[model samples]
Every structure is written in structure tokens, then in C-alpha cells.
Target: MPVVREFTLPDLGEGLTGAEIIRWLVEVGEVVAVDQPVVEVETAKASVEVPCPYGGVVTARFGAVGEEVPVGAPLVTVAVAASEGDDDAGGSGNVLVGYGTAGHSAAPRRRRVRPVQTRPAAVPAPQPTAQPAPRPARSGPLPVISPLVRRTARELGVDLATVSGSGPDGLILRADVTRAAAAVVSRETSAAAPEPAVAWDDDVVPLRGLRRTVAEKLSRSRREIPDATCWVDADATGLLALKDQLAARAAAPRIGLLPLLARICTAALARHPDLNASVVTEPDGTPTGIRRHRAVHLGFAAQTERGLMVPVVRDAQLLTTEQLAAEMARLTEAARTGSLTPAELTGGTFTLNNYGVFGVDGSTPIINHPEAAMLGVGRIAAKPWVHDGELAVRQVTQLSFTFDHRVCDGGTAGGFLRFVADCVENPGELLRYL
Candidate 1:
């Protein structure tokens, strides 16, 4: 008899507790290799493909796509040949990407597994727009794998044995149950007097996946953090002039406006180390004490099709303007292509949000939680400004700084913003800290 081994969702690390199933890579009754990616999941940080350490015939999958599964919850159950596993259901000591195992199991040889037939069972149905096809009558163990699916079927009075499965290998999915329930309603409605349809669900958007994560985090930031915003208008003429002069030089690495500002922000953080820290909070979210960081892990906000992502540049205080430009470019590309790792998306001690790319003047955006502050840069445009005691049209930009009031008072926050503004106006002053 093949030993049925369950594979749980391994911890993806970086303080993540659960992940939303983005898509299923393998189907029921498919033969899988050791360490083969079985599913793609999106955590609070990034989307990661989870591989199974045990190779065998996949008997069942636990969660539906778009459903959140907690860490340690079963993801799939594989029927491994007794010979393939050393002891009981012979398990592999093989490790997995985006997850970790305690230790390797010795003498676990990679072997091919032929798909096995699943014991049949029934599941109830639920309401769905698409109709599910009919399945021949079968009786056995429940065909449903996920407990949540079973719950839905029970609540909706769906009969698992009667309902047809639209999932892989006749596995009854939650949607199939939902569709069954919907069909029952439709039939019942036809028996009654015809009423006009409301189309109530047309405009309703579900807060799920990335959008849900973003919403929860932003809500926490607002609820927990005592934040204050401060802004300043600076003459960016000197900054633009400096960029042009540097580009004119040989092998200057194609300087950009954001990198230069990033350099300035790092210099300012170095001067005021107080801003480069996170507040240690209690279980009740009480601010206990301030914890200072030695290195500056700067995060820049990048908007992707998925949602807003902050890709962190490790040790931004150490990167030169050109180096910062290159790293920022790399991270930006990764963010846009949705290839960023969770490590790259987290542990940001401070954030730089260049909303200027969106053609906005200024915004007092919410501070990214746990981080002390975020510097927002707006569009740089030619505007009427003073240059050396003379009124002239100069490139001007609005820089806004939002900080956690628990870490520092208004005076410290104002000073940090002032230093950044001075660097923008005088460009050469940025060299003193460099």
C-alpha cells in the first residue's frame, strides 16, 4: 500500500504567517518529482512558487486559488510508494525553495510515481454563475480535500455525492459546490413568479490577495503609528544642473533624479540617525522603546500591476549616487516584472516614495508601518522661484517628509527635511556628508 504523506505549507520566512494561493501548478492524480513546484502563492511580501519535498502521486490539494492558507496547514497529500520512503511513508530530507525543512531524510531515492485512482465521495454545491457538468453517481469517502470546502458544502446544503467536481481528477472544488447551490436557487426562482433582476453584485469588488494585504497594512499603520507630515518647496535648479554636468562626464552610469535624491536622503539619515529606526512595540501595540539601526536599508515605492511594492536597497548609506541609480533600476525592473523576492520587499528601515513619477505636486501619504519615516518627492517642473536674491524661473519640486512622532518631535523632523531641502537647493552641500 502506498503511504499517504501530507505536505503542509512551509513557512516562507520573513515573519509571514500565511499566503493566498495564486494558482495551482499540479493537479490531482499527477506524478510529481521531489522539490517540484506545486503551487504559486502570494504572501504579504511577494509571490513565491512552493515546491513539494515529497515526490509521489498528488491525491488531493487543500486550498483553492485566491484562498488564504495559514502556515503549517496541509497543501497537498501525496501517496508515496513504501519503498520510495525509508521508514513508513518514506519521506525525503530534500529541502524546498521559499521554505525550509528540519533535516534531510537519509536514503531517500528519487522515484517515479504513477498516478493512483482516488477513493470516491460526494460534496454539496453552492451558488456560482457558471454551471457545473453532471457527474455519475459515486459513493465513498468525501471527494473534498479542504475543510473550508466541506464547510461551504454543508452550509449550502450541497450534496457532495450528487454534485459534480470541476477540479482535477474529479476532485470536488468549492466553486463546484457553489455552482450547485446556485443551480438549486435558479430552479426554485423559476418555479415562483418572475421578478426583475437587480444585478447587485456587478459593481462589487472583492478585497482579496494583494489589495487586501495593502489595505490591512495601511490600516494598521494609521491605527498604530502616531504620524505627522511636513513639506518644503525647494529650488531644484542646482540639482538638475549637477545631473547634467555629471552626465557630460565619461562613464557616469546615466544618473537619474531619484538616485540623487536617494543619496541626499541617506546623507541626511546619517546626520540624524534618530530617523533611521523602528519603534519596538508591545503585544498591545504600545510603543515601548526606540530601536536604532546602524545600517540604512532604504525602500523605494514601485507601483506594479499587482499592487504597491517597496523594494529595499540594502545599505543605501554606502551606495554612491551612480551605484544607487543602478541598484534602484534593478529593483524597479524586478518590481515591475513581479520577480522581486520577499527579502527584497521587506526590512525597510526607511522608505523613499517618488510619487513625482505620477505627475503629482505633493502628497502627505501614509508612512509605511514599523519604519520610522518616508520621504515623498513630487514632480520637478519649471516654476517661478528665487535664485541668489533674484526672481527667476527655476526647476522647483515639493518634498514632503512623513515621520513617526513617537521616534522624534517636530523639530527633529523639520531639521531632517530642511537638510534635504538645502541639498536640493545647493547640490554642493550634499558633498559635505559624502
Candidate 2:
């Protein structure tokens, strides 16, 4: 006798609830080893490979690629051979998020086909044409793994089991449920022979995955945080010169304008620690006090194909210009490649956004939730500016600072922005802070 055990999706940590299946590495009836990566899933944070903790023949898979599966939901079922005198089904002694390793009763076994039992019966005359038996009806969970799909079906009053799935191995997707619902509406309209004057679902884009997370956080930030934005037109001539000088050096690491701006932001934060803190909330979600941070974990926004993401650079205040440039480059590459982990995507006391890359002059971007401030830099171009009491062509840029008004008064925010602007106008001013 073989014992079948169901494996549920494990938590991927960092408070993630679910993940979208990117690819399935295993197929039904295939032999698998303990701790083998069965599926690659893309969470809001990163793409991760999920391993199965059971070693046996895979009997069934619940979700298809592109379907989201919640934590603790059934992922796959494996059939393990029962050892003699052992009643328990063995599990692999491998530990992953949401589950721990456990002892097994028997060693691993190879996969084999089960023998069919035969019974003697009286033979009957065969018909000239034999028709094949109908396919067995699928039941028990509807092959739908996503809760979103189930909820959509229920809200639209669609029978999930009756609709054929277009996904791999007949797994029901959200689109399938929606199409079934649309068919029902079509039939209803055909009976009435009428047309409506409005389209509700047209041009509607779903907010899911990273976009959904960003929307919720931004909405909360706008609703709760009293934000104020201040802008300054600064002469970035010196900063560009400084970057050129560093790049012209023999051994100095090639520096960009962002590293210099990052340095300036850190210096300003150090001077005005009030803007570097987040508000601490009580149990009921009311602001109780401010929790000032001693170190700066800086987050910088990077635009990727998925959407906008903020990747944090830890202990940014302590790193040099070269080091900051290196870390920023590394994080930007990871963000572009969708390889950043959840840890790298969150937990920042401040954010630095360089919207200049997009050729925009300035923007009042919403503050990243739980963070106190965000510094935005716009494109630096040659503009007429006052230099040495005379109008001259200078490399000018727009800098905007959006801060939580509750964290500090306008004087503090103004002073911080002024200091950053001064640093941009005179790159030598950073030496005083150093």
C-alpha cells in the first residue's frame, strides 16, 4: 500500500501572503527527490524557486503557471511507498519557510507502476463498433488554486467545474472564470435582444502583485501622512564638474551624479535627525510617538518592467561615494533583472528618487509608507543662472523634498533642502560634514 501526502504552499517569509507561479518544474507522475525545486514563483518582492519537501511520485499539481497560490494552500500531492509495519507517511527532513524538518520512518524508494488486480468474468459478444467511455468527472476543489479566482466565480455566479480550463493540465484560471461569466451574460442578452449604452470593464487594468502593493501603500500614505513638498533650483555645475574630475582619475571609481546627491542627502539627514525618523503608532493605529533612527537605510526608486520598485541600500550614511555608487549600481541591476529579495525591497528610513532619468523636470512623488521623507532630483541641464553676481550658463537642476509634516516643522525641512542645494552648488561643502 502507498500513502499519499498533500504538500501545501509554504510561506516565503517577510509577511508575504501569496505568489504567482512563473513556471512548473515538475509534472504529474514524475519522480522527485527531497527538496527538489518544483515550481518557480514570483512574489511581490522577487522570483523564488519553491522546493518540495517530500520525495516520491508526484500525483497531482493544483495550480498552473501565472496563477497565484496563497500560503498553506495545497500545492502538490505525492505518493510514498508504505514501509512494512510502518503506518506513517514519511516526509523529507528538509526545512523551509512555514514548515520545519521532521523525521521519516523509511528510506527513499524508486517510483514504480502499481499492478492492477484482475477478476474472472463471463465473456460477452463484442459490438462491431465500440465507443470509448466518457472521461471521469473532476471534483473536489475544481482544480482552482487561487482564492481570487474562486471569489470571482462566486461573485459572478459562474460554475467553475463546468468551464473547461485553458491552462496546463486543466487548471482553472481567473480568465476562465471571467469568460464563463461573460458567456452567461451573452446568453442572457441574446434572450432579451438588447444592447446597453455603457461599457464598465473597458480599459480597466487590474491592480495586482507589485502594482497592488504600491497602490495600497501610496493610498495609505496619502490618507494618513500630512505631507509637504518644497522645491529649489540649484546650480549643479560644480557637481557635474566633480563627477567629471572623479571619472578622469586613474584609480578612482567612475562616479555618477546620483552618488553625489546621495552623499548630500545623507549629510543633510545627519544634520537634521528629526526628518530621518518614522512615526510610531499605537495598537489602534494612532500615532503615539516618533522613533528616530540612528543609522540611515536609504531606499532609491528604480523603474522596472514590472513597475516602480524601491530597493534599499543599508547603512547608506556610512558608505563612501565610491561604495554608494557600487551598491546603487548593484541594486539597480538586481531590480532591472527582477532578482531583488524582499529584504532589499523594504525597510527604509528615507528614499532618494532620481526622476531626472525620465527627462522630467520635477515631481511631487508620494512618500514611501512608514518612511518620513523622500528626496527627488530632476534633470540637470544648462540654464541661465546667477554666478558671482552675474548671469551665466550653468548646469542647473531642480530638487524637490517631500516630507511628512508631522515629523518636523517647515523650518527643519527647509534647512535640510537648503543644505542639500548648497552641497549641489558647491561640491566642496561636503568636506565640512566629512
Candidate 3:
């Protein structure tokens, strides 16, 4: 008798209820060792590869790629135990390495109630000589475009079918809709005729994946947490010069402003520990006060192929600027290629979002969950300002900080921002503190 065991999907941590299957590395009839990677799953924040927990011959796979599987659902099964003295009877032919134990009893399998398939009544076969009728001409309302475009067209009172499309395969775009509206205006003016204004048709967009997660998180953050935003303009001339000098130096490691920003934030947290804390409420409807953290795990908001992901640099306060830069680069590359592990995406004590790369001036970024504050860096631009009692051109950047008012006081937040600004303005000062 052979005993089989089924391995179910384990919680990848962070209380995630489910994940989308990205790929399956194992197949049926293949022997696998414990801790061997078997499947890749994509959560809202990141994609993670999961290792098998049992050693045995793979008997079945429960989920397909791109399908979402709930936590504790059976993912794969293996035959681990066999009758004694059955080695010559095709029992346990090969033992998997790294798996010390065997012959574990399998859990009771859950039977899914699949819908019964019924044979459909056979239809009379069509004659071979019968010709198919041509499709009816698209009339009346001009075969309305997509619901989104149709709503825009109706709101502008422009006929979509008459509008020329510049999109691929002659599909209408938002720009085409705007142009059609303008053309209608011009034609009505020339003909001295009045056109009736049309109202927009109701439209809907399905929320899924990152967009859906973003919506839910943001809504909860806004409704539950009281947020306050503070803005400051900083002189980045010194920072730019330092970056260029470092890039040109042979001994200095190549780096960007992001790593420098992370270092500054880590240092600032030491002074204003309140901003480094989170507000947690008790289950009995009582609000427990601020909780400050000791470790500085800085989360860097990275834009990836699937969506936005934040991978943390653990204990950034202890790392040298060079080490921080190298780690940031490695983690960023891993995020872009979907190779980041689950551990890398968790335990962030603070977050830094670089909107400067996108040429944005400033934005109030939402704090990553459980972190009280987040900082946004804007584009550095040359502008005229009064310096040393004289008008001079200097590189200036905008800083936006959003914090949970429940945890961080306005004064503490202001001081923290000023500290970061000081670090950016005086690069040499960082070395002294370090």
C-alpha cells in the first residue's frame, strides 16, 4: 500500500488571502524534493516563487497558471509511503534528497462538486451548398465604440461611427473623440445650425489586480487615518554636484540621489522617532498611542512591469552610503525582473518614493502601511533665487511629506523634513554624521 500526501499553498506572510499563479515549475509523474521550487505566485505587491514542502512523485496539480488560488488550497500531491519489502515491486524507486522524512499519512482530500456535462441535442447538418448570409450593415447609432469612448462621444454629442480613428485597426481613441467634437463644432458654426447637447451614457470599469488593490488601500488609508501633508522647497545644487563628482570618481561607487535620500531619512528618524512610529488601535475600540520602531527598514518604491512594488533595505541606518547604493541597485533590478523574494518586500519601517525621475514637481505620497510617514522627491530644476543677497541661478527641488497625524506631530514632521533638506544641501555633512 502506498500512502500519498498533498501539499497545500502556505501563507506567504502578511496575511495575504490569495495569489495569482504565474507559473508551475513541476509536472505530474515527476519526483520532487522538499523545499524545491514548484510554482510562482503574483500578489498585489510582488511576485514570489514558492517551494514544495513534501518529497514524492507529483500526482496532480490543482490550479492553472494565471488562476487565483486561495490560501490552504491543495496545490500538488506526492506518494511518500509504500508497503514494506516492496522495493522490487515498483515502490519508492528513488529517494528525494534534502527530504529526511517519508511515509507521512495524507490528509483527507476535499471533493469538488463539478457540474455534470450533458450531451446537447444534435442539430440537423447544414447542406454543403447553402451559402451563409452576409452580416447586416451596422446601422443606427453607428455601432457605438467602447463604453468609455461611447460615454465621451455622447457627452460631446459627436457620432462615433462618423469619427475617423487613428488607432491601430482603425479603432477610435480619446484623441479621436476630442477631434470629432471639435469638427462637429466647426461644421455647425459654418452651417449656422444649432446642435442639441447630448448627455453621457453611464459607463463602468472593472477593478482588478494592482488598480483594485490601490483603490482599496487608499480608501482605507484616507477614511481611517487622519493624514497631514507638509511641503518644502530645497536647494539641490550641492546634491547634484556631489552626484556628478561621485559618478566621475574611480574609488567612489556609482550612485544616484535615491540612496542618498534613504540615508538622510534613516538619520532623520533617529532625531524624530515619532515619525518613525505607527498608530495601532486595540480590538476593544480603544486607540493605543504611537509605537516607535528601533530598526530602520527603508522601503524604496520601485516601478515594475506588473505594477508598483516596494522592496525594503533592511537596517539602512547601519549601512554605509556605498553599501546602501549597491543594495538599492540590486533590489531594484530584482524587482524589475520579478525575481524578488517575499522577505524583501516586507518589514519596511519607512518609505521613499522618487517622483523626480518622472519629472514631477511634488506629490503627497501615501504612507506604506504600518509606517507613519512617507517622503516624495520631486524633479531638480534650475531656477532663479536670491542667494547671498544677490539673484543667482541654482538647482532647486520640491519635497512633499505625508504623515499620519495620529502618530506624528506637525512640529516633529517639520523638523524631520528640515533634517533631510540639510543633508541634501550639505553632502559633506553626511560623512561627519556617519
What C-alpha lDDT values do all the predictions have? 0.80, 0.79, 0.70
For each candidate in turn, the TM-score is 0.78, 0.81, 0.68
- In model 3, which runs have C-alpha deviations exceeding 4 angstroms? 1-5, 26-36, 53-59, 78-214, 284-286
Per-residue C-alpha lDDT of model 2 across residues 140-179, encoded as one tens digit per residue? 6466546688887898898877877655345567878877
Let me know the TM-score candidate 2 reaches against the reference structure. 0.81
Could you arrange the candidates by TM-score from highest to lowest? 2, 1, 3
Off by more than 4 A, model 2: 1-6, 29-34, 54-57, 78-146, 154-173, 185-203, 283-285
Write candidate 1's Cα lDDT for 240-331 as tens digits: 99888988887668888889989999999999999999999999998889999999999999899987888999999988888999999999
Worst 10 residues of 3 by lDDT: 93-102
Let me know the TM-score candidate 3 reaches against the reference structure: 0.68
In terms of lDDT, model 1 sits at 0.80
Name the runs in model 1 displaced over 4 angstroms: 1-7, 26-34, 54-63, 72-83, 88-98, 101-198, 249-252
Model 3 per-residue lDDT at 387: 71
| RMSD over all Cα atoms, model 3 | 12.4
Among these predicted structures, which one has the highest TM-score?
Answer: 2
